[model samples]
Target chain A: MRLLEALALTITNGSKPVCRNQNFHLQAGEIWGVLGPNGIGKTSLLHTLAGLRKPLSGQITLMDKPLASYDRKQLATQLGIVFQDSQDTFPSTVLETVLMGRHPYLSEWAWESVEDISLCMTALEQVALATLAQRQVNTLSGGERRRLALAILLVQNPSICLLDEPTNHLDLHHQMVLLELIVQKTLRNNGGVVMVLQDVNLVPRFCTHVLLMHNADSWISGPVADVMTTTNLQLLYQHSIRKLVDNGVTLFYPE
Target chain B: MPVFSPAVPVLSGRYFLVLFFVALFAALSFVVALGLGSADISFNDIVAVLTGTSDSLNQQIILQIRLPRVQTGMCVGGMLAMAGCLMQILLRNPLAEPYVLGVSGGAAVFALLAIVSGLSGLWINGSAFAGALLSIFLVFVLSRIGNDWNPLRILLTGVVISAGWSAFISFLLAVSPPDQLHGMLFWLMGDLSYVQSSFWNPIVLAVVLLPSLVYARSMNLLATGDLNAAALGVNVTRLQYFIYFASSLLTATAVMQGGSIGFIGLVVPHLVRILFGSDHRILLPVSVMLGGSLLVIADGLARSLIAPEQLPVGVLTAMLGVPLFLVLLQTILFRQRT
Candidate 1:
């Protein structure tokens, strides 16, 4: 099933259009990685896809319906996005922060039920933040905060997950563990995952497909084996790249 | 995977305990305020007067003067605190208060005009309320000049208008006669000596608080950021407007009742947040209760501190709140370090 489709999409960063006339369909049970160098509009593209930003010129549909047709609450049920960074204007507990995921599912005057709390706790444990449920969010480390954001997205349980730099600030072990967890969870629920990643080597291992944003009005996306080549990556980053195979696993490195 | 249970019970227990203490403090302050006036009525006399068993001058004192004054103090304090809480969330600034948006400045200008015109009682209050409404309208309109309603824009607009009102207030003060100057100064300093018992203040408080409590959860999400709250399923635009109007109404009503009393609105919410967590479900009501009680006590001090020459309650609140908040912060920091 198609979870998200962008037709004739043109995303911009408020001053200049970044990617133009892009077309992509994210299907259920597939994880797509968006790779780009610095200053590229990867975050803007993800924001546009999540309906947080207006596409410069394009159409986005979720579950075969126009994205703009649904109200915020309804859209949240079908899609969730983990921003690059979370803001803490006021102090709140870790559990309280995670419980916000259930906001869309719950009514205006309702409190979180036991099942909701259970789901949040399970998500926290999956993210290795179960012990810090009572700790204040402002006291968390950057990596811990990132895990907390992922936990919130997990608890949201939307069909389409749009993550901007999901592995940002995470150590190598947590990066691998959490990404694997997100992929496994998405596949288990037959959901679609699109995450912008900084690590080039992580794509071949976690993403089933790749969307390489070269520059404004230029891009290529296909299965990882098809689009993730030395030439394509070199062109994407405007640098030299070398591809190597170790024990039948493919990896790319900058030369 | 390991299974874990949420800390709901612990949090709920803390909520109940904090609420219970704040409510008790409010009740105690009410009783103490009624008994500690110039006439010095005893606790038993207050109870007797309340129960309609005492027919002495104490009855008249407690029933006629102190009762209305205490009630007014409670209403104004609760309204201001609730307004301040909403303003902080709306502007996403901890320093935001009921008067930060020029409501009080407009009120001060108009109330001074009324005093300069030799108006008393209801006329001054009516003019102040009108001025507050005018301020609200101006800020709302000016902030949306380019159809932008961001917090920074709204805040800047309010501050500018407030400055304009301040200049007008200075002009009014400069030309007023010496006799009317006393009343004008009292108004600016937030005197509550002449407030009468009316149902409107409580009604307004209930009206504003009900919706605020109902939307408290959304407010928690909103305090993060607009995009964050919207992505979390909160109707950010609708909620923002609701906060804007609701807090303005709260500030307007509070200024009308008590001449734009300060400190309670600004400090009470922070005090409550420091004691309890920032969960609005608990924060809103507790702040109201604590604010009402603190103002009631402050008003009592204002009345009896000089025994006959009553000081402005706002002065007392600021004097009291500054030390209290500082000590509380220091103790909390010390505890954390230990």
Candidate 2:
């Protein structure tokens, strides 16, 4: 129902260009995985798409119009973005933090209405943080905080979500939880998720599409079955991969 | 399980402490100050003179001159401290204050130019306010260079503006008649003796700074950093610009009216923060009240410390305020470290 397109995108930070002649499109109803080495500009690309960053060249369009045309707050209503690092200044409770999603709709001084509080709690309920609503943001455990971050975005009610690293600071179980929640939100809204990931095997499981960036070069990207082969994984990472069948699931990891 | 009272709030509990001590100390200063001078008046007589309206000059001394000056000290002192607190919170820096941040220096330069250029009385206050505004405006512009908008720009610009103004004030001092030079220097260092009741206008004008800062209950969000604030949909650019203009307007108004009250802006906010923490709602009002009381005490000491010789009130404020300020700064840093 919705299409987000990056048209002939180029990103440069003064000297040499970082990304050049790149294009990607996301149609609603599936998650797209971005796989890349450390300097491959995965985060930068996500930032540009979210309108949090300005690109050196090229344009992005949603629903056939230029991306810049969407007012940032309005775009926020349709697209939620999760940043990589947590900040130090926010001292509001989890409930207050999540309710900030209603910022674009409320006047500068209006109190959060019952509807706003309900929406925020609903996001907390989705993330299994309903009990943590009164807890200070700084007091949350790393895994819990990441969950809260997602909850805040969920309250934003965006149709298309962009996550730089949904699992960056998470332990294994929390990582699984975050991935599950993202998948659930996308499926419920018939929305798309474009996520940056380094773990290659994760792409085949929850991600419907995968894009790999290696040594400053853009590589294979397509449906998981076509792009997530052992040879392609090895070429993109410059490492070997071993696939093992455990129970019924196919697991791929570097040997 | 610690249910923090939303009303009393942790911040108020802490800030009320600094507020109380400064208030009590100012009250003591008022009583002691009324008992001295070349024509020594008994403390009891001063109180009696204050309550009953006698047509005598001695009674007039208690009512019109002494009482208003003391009241003026209390009001102006509070206004300066309030201005300092607002500036610090607006900039989101603990080190930000009105006097040292070039708001006063800029205003002082303008007021000086107006005074020597044949402007006198009320005209001096307006010129000073305009000067302070211009200086702070310039500093704000310089700091926001390339739109990077760092605190360092404001700090550096303030220092440069102060140096330039200091040079200009010195040049004016060099050419003025010898009798007037002492008066000019006294004004530069900041004194509270010319305590006119009409100075209340600037105080009223500064009321806007209070709400501009208080409304940002979201300012606590800023402590998280600009990127985080932006991600939260904080109109970051707009907030930054608004704070800069508001703090400048407030600081300029105080500097124009109060010659140069010292240490209240810098030290009071620091003390309040150490006692209360960094919430603006608590910090702002506490700073205002404490600032008033502190100046009352300082002005009292300036008048009464010597039998007949009156000292500059700024001298006394720095004398009392600096040592306490150092102790607070040291205690805060040490506690924060380990």
Candidate 3:
């Protein structure tokens, strides 16, 4: 099933156009990575795809309907976005924060049922945060907070997931665990995942397809094997690259 | 079959227990406030009047004088605190309160106009409400100039509008006759003693609170930030409108009842958050209860502090709330540093 499709999309910041003439299609059972240099409209493209930003000149359809046609509630049940960071000004417990994901399913003034609570609990356990569910979110560290964000999205159970910098702050162990969890969950549900990442190695390892944004009005996107070549990556990053092929895996790094 | 272990869930039993105590405290404060006048009505006398066994002078004082006053206090206090909670959530700023958006200043300006023109009772209330609604509309329109409903823009607009309202208020005061100054000052300082009937206050309180309670869950999502709420499927724009309208009406009603009572709105929610968690489902109700109780006690003190003379209830709320607010700020600063 087609999860999201963009046609001739153009995004702008103020009067200046940031990206132009973009076309992409995301389908179920696919993991796509969006990569670019800093300030190259990567976040803007991610946000535009997630319906957080409107394209300057094109149409976006989600779940076979126009993105603008769906109301907030309808859109929320099908699509979820995990932000890079979240602020915790008010002191709500981790459990309470995670349970907020059930909001789209439940009616107003209805309490969380046993099923909702259990789902949130399972998501917390998946993120290794079940024990800290009683603690305040304000007391969490940067990595733990990111895990909690993932946990919230897990509990939300959206068909399509949009994540920006999903591994920005994490230890080596957690980075692998979170990426695997996201890929596993999306594949299980037959949904697509879109991620904005900076790491070069993670893209070749996990992403089924890759979109490399160079500057405004320019981009290259294709299957990971076709797009993530040593020459292409070196040109995209404007740097000298060293490539190594060990068995079936390929690694690209700047020399 | 060898062993059975019950899983201890994370759910705690303290919520209901704490709620019960808060209600009990409000009830206790209500009963205590009834007997705290210069006429010296005893606890037994209040009970006798309630049970229909007494018809003495003290009964008249309790029923005619103190009962309506206390009821108004509770309603006004609850309304202010509830409005404050909504404002804080809408702006995502801890220091945001009811009057931070100039609702009270607008009310005070129009209310002073009515008072100076010798308008009595409902006319004053009507004008104050109209003025408050005007301020709400002005702030809403001005803040949406070239962007979406940005909290910083809204807040900055409200603060500037508040400054404008204060200047208007000063001009009104400067031109008013000397004889009406006492009445104007009393009204501006917030006097619960002037509350005659308790019908509209309770009705407005219920109308605003019941609907707002239904949206408590959304408010919880909003406290995190706009993006989080939006991505989670909440209609952030619609929710912001609901909050602004509800909070403005609540503040207008409170100002109409008791002339812009301060600090109860600003302080009560923080106090409730400190005690209970920040879930609005719990914080909203507890804030209303505690706000009502605190105002009743403050009014009691205001009435009894100089027996035979009364002080504006706002004075006591500020005196009591300022110190508590200072302590809260200090604690917040202390936490940020570490």
Candidate 4:
């Protein structure tokens, strides 16, 4: 099933188009990694996809309906996004922060039910943050806060997950663990996952497809094996790149 | 897999228990304030007057004089505290208070003008209320010029307007005659001496309280940030407008009643948050109760402190709230550290 489709999408950063005339279809159980260089509007594209900002031009459809047709609450039920960073402007418990995932499902003036809380706890456990559920969110370390954000997305349980730099601030072990968990959960629920990633090597291991944003009005995308060649990566980053194979696993690095 | 339990009870029995105690304290403060006037009426007489059994001069004193004053204080205090709580959430700043938006300043400027023009009674309150509405309108229009209702923009606009009002207030004070100075100063300091018991106070409280309680959960989500709240499925623009209008109305009503009683709005919410957590479901109602009770007690002290020479209730609230808040903060911090 097609979970998300972008037709001739033009994403922008206020005035200028970041990427123009992009077309893509995200299907169930497919994890698409958006790879780009620094300051290339990856986050802006993600924000546009999540309906948090207006795309410069073009249309986005979620679940075969126009994205603009859905109100914020309705959109939240069908899609979720984990921002690159979260700001802690007020004091709140870790559990309370994660339980905000249930916000769209709850009616006005209703409190979280037992099942809602159980889901939050399970998500926290998945992120290794169950023990800190009662701790204040402001006191958390950078990596811990990142995990908390992931936990919130997990609890939201949307069919289409749009993550901006999901591996940011995580250590090596946690980076692998969390990416695997997200892929497994998406496959289990037959959902689609699109994550903006900084690590080039992570894309081949975890993503079935990759969207390489070369520059404004230029792009390439296909299965990881086809589009993740050293030549394509070198063109994408405007640098020389080399490829190697170790124990049948493909890897690319800057030469 | 490990079994998991809730870290904190979202809306549990303990919160209700705390609310019950705060309500009980408010009731006790009301009774105590009713009984502690120049002519010391006994507790029995106070209860008798309240229950419609007493018919003496004591009954007249209780019904005619103290009841209205205490009732006005409670209503004004509750309104201010709730406004403060809303402002804090609306601005997403812990330092926000009801008057931070210049509502009270506008009210004060017009109130001082009314006093200088030889106006008394409802004239001062009416002008003050009009001034407050004007300020609310000004902030609302100015902050929304670009249709960007961001918190920082709203806060900056309010602060600048408040500064302008202060200049006008100083100019008025500078020009007013000596004979009117006493009343002008008293009004500026937030005196409740002349406030009569009106049905509008309770009515306004109910009108504001119900809608705010309904939106309390959205308030929690909003405190994170506007975009984050939007991502969490809240209608950010609508909620911001609601908070701006509701809190402004609350401040206007409070200023009309008691001349912008300070500290209660700013301190009472913090007091409640320190005792309870920052859950708006509990924070809003609890802040109202505590604020009302504290103001009633402060008004009682203001009345009896000099026995016929009443200090402005605002003065007493600052004097009382500062030390109490500091002590609570110190205790909580020490406990957390240990």
Kindly indicate the candidate among 1 and 2 with the higher DockQ.
1
Put down candidate 3 lDDT per residue, A91-206, tens digits, no spaces.
Answer: 77788889989889988867777788899989999999999887668888999999999999998989899999999788889999999998999999999999999898889888
C-alpha lDDT score of every prediction, in listed order: 0.88, 0.71, 0.85, 0.88
RMSD of each: 2.9, 5.7, 4.1, 2.7
TM-scores for every candidate against the unseen true structure: 0.96, 0.75, 0.93, 0.96
lDDT of 2 by residue, B83-125 (tens): 6765665555656677656777777777777767777777888
Cα deviation in Å at residue B277, candidate 4? Answer: 0.9
Per-residue lDDT of candidate 4, residues A1-255 (tens digit): 999998999887867678888898899989999999998899998888888888878999998999989999888888999999998766678998898989999988788888888999999999999998888788899999999999988988888899999999999999999999988988899999999999999998999999999888888998998999988998899999998999988888887
- Between prediction 2 and prediction 3, the one with superior lDDT is 3
Clashes of 3: 0
Best-performing candidate as measured by DockQ:
4
Poorest 10 consecutive residues of model 2 chain B by lDDT?
Answer: B1-10
Candidate 1 pairs with clashing backbones:
none
Q: What is the DockQ score of candidate 4, to 2 decimals? A: 0.57
Per-residue lDDT tens digits of candidate 1, residues A122-165?
99999999999977788899999999999999999888899999
Write model 1 residue lDDT over B1-338, tens digit each, in one string: 00122356224555577678778889999999887667777889888988889977988888889999999898889989999999999999999999999999999898888888888899999999999999999999999887558999999999999999999999998998888888888888888899999999889988888888889989999998988888988888899999999989989988987896888988998888777767788889988888898898999999999988899999999999999999877876675565
Worst 10 residues of 4 chain B by lDDT: B1-10
Candidate 3 TM-score to native = 0.93
Candidate 4: list runs displaced more than 4 Å.
B1-7
Between candidates 2 and 4, the lDDT winner: 4
